[model samples]
Target: MEQKHGTPIEWLMPLAFCTVFGWVVWHTPAFILDFGPENQQLAALYARLDVSPGLAPLFGGYGDIIDYGALLLSPLIFIGGVMTVRRAPMEFESWRAIDRVAVFIGRITMMLIVLLTSVMIYEVILRYVFEAPTLWANELSLWLAGFVFLLAGLYAMQQRSHIRIFLLYDAVPRWLQRVFDVVSTSLIVIFAAALIYGGYGEAFAKFMRWETFGTAFDPPIPATLKIMVLVIIALVAIQAVINLISDWNAVPVVHTAADDIDQDELERLKAAVGNEGVGELDVTRGAIQGNQSEHK
Candidate 1:
């Protein structure tokens, strides 16, 4: 399929996400330094808490210190969601820029795998070879894992990879399917709204005060993860809305067990593997055909 390129206006959501996440990634070193006790001015500028109406008791006695990381990431999470919602829903095989951003996110998140592996390898060397152990390795890996797991939801939503019960759904009438879509999307939006609204004060307080996980490698991971969750949930809801709008006029499709198999998949795989003479695998006849289509 030919890919459609949108105008400058359509590029805004993606650009916004890139800008915000980019800022956070770039400023991370400074952010960490800002939280250090030696840097009073930077700390004050970045992590000073708005003490009024704070949920101080929630943090187990640490007075509120603003969460710079969460604050920085909030815009990325939001703009990422907006970008997802703005994306035109495409088939799984079709490549588009909107989908490319999700893939971009997925690619970046793959860094966690590298981080986890590197951390474990370093820990092994430290413990076995150097006769030392570091608390930071495990915790840092855990921290990386948190973002990897959480950010995956956005990618899955873009790919429409979430598990669904299609037995009844696929067989429904077009109007009925639309109704189902509306109800489901409405529930998701409601849940996201409630989560944000109900937990706003709590998240705000935690992030505002720079709450720690209380480990030796004390990262503000908890605060950042919580905010990330809220942000992603809102984004998922927005994507659902976009899906509904995009799919509302579509015809309902009924699928049987047989429809689950696609013979062309094997052909594509063979082509990918550089098998020049490989032909389409005819699943029904259980044979490979020289031509792209099966002989009737």
Candidate 2:
């Protein structure tokens, strides 16, 4: 099927995400050093967030997610959502900028999950085997897990991995299916818009202040993540709009139990039973299996 991805300049969105990612990672230590009440410039810039317990907590309702280490990612993601109709080509070889960026984010998220798992394994070994538990592993895993979950939604939309209960809609006429698509996309847009409107003030406050986790690790996971939620949801809404317009004439995608079944797995299971992996017939019936070429 044909598709459309408007304008080549949409590369700006991915650039924003990457640039902020690089900036935050680079200047984290400096931001922490300057993030204090005495430094009027940094204090006013960072809002009411303190890196450690010595500082006062003002306008800090979130966890240890507001540190200077990871503050710029939120804004980068918001920039990624600036264009409501931008989309990636369906083909991997012909992917556009947004498609590549989404894939890049997905790979990073996967690495984070792997890192989280490794930390858990290391913690287990230290606690049970060495009998010396560490303080940072649990918080570290929690921090990575939060971003993994948040970013997974955006990747899912890019790959069309979302679940759809299509029983009624698939059975309906093409026109009716189009109507259902419109209604569903409209609901998603409305929900995302409502969340941004309600949470914008809080996210902005946390972002401007650069809050931090009160724990010993004290990473800036909260403020950045709060900002991320609004940004990613807006991205999701914009993707829905793009899908709504681009797939307007898409054919009904019928799904069934058989569709969900893995044919290769089924064949392997069939072979383990000592039966030749032929279709629907018994050897005891004295019927020779038909030739594969004949069936074709």
Clashes of each: 4, 10
Which tens-of-lDDT digit does each residue in 28-63 have in candidate 2? 434544443344544443343333535343345221
TM-score of 2: 0.65
Best by TM-score: 2
Candidate 1: clashing pairs of residues? 65-209, 65-210, 66-208, 67-207
Residue lDDT tens for model 1, 1-296: 23333445444544454445644533343444544334454355333322322533223322223334445565666555434434333435434444555654654465456657888999999999999999888887787788878778877776667877788886777788888889998998999999999988888666655566778876667667887788878877877776677667665544444344665776676778766545433333334222324565
Query: How many clashes show up in model 1?
Result: 4
Candidate 1, residue 286: Cα displacement in angstroms equals: 14
Stretches off by above 4 angstroms in model 2 are: 1-97, 273-296
Q: Assess each prediction's global lDDT (C-alpha) against the native.
A: 0.61, 0.62
Cα TM-score of candidate 1: 0.60
Q: After superposition, which runs of candidate 1 have C-alpha atoms over 4 Å from their true positions?
A: 1-101, 128-130, 250-296
**Which lDDT value does model 2 have at 75?**
61
Which residue pairs show backbone clashes in model 2? 46-209, 47-209, 64-213, 65-220, 65-221, 65-222, 65-223, 66-211, 66-220, 67-220
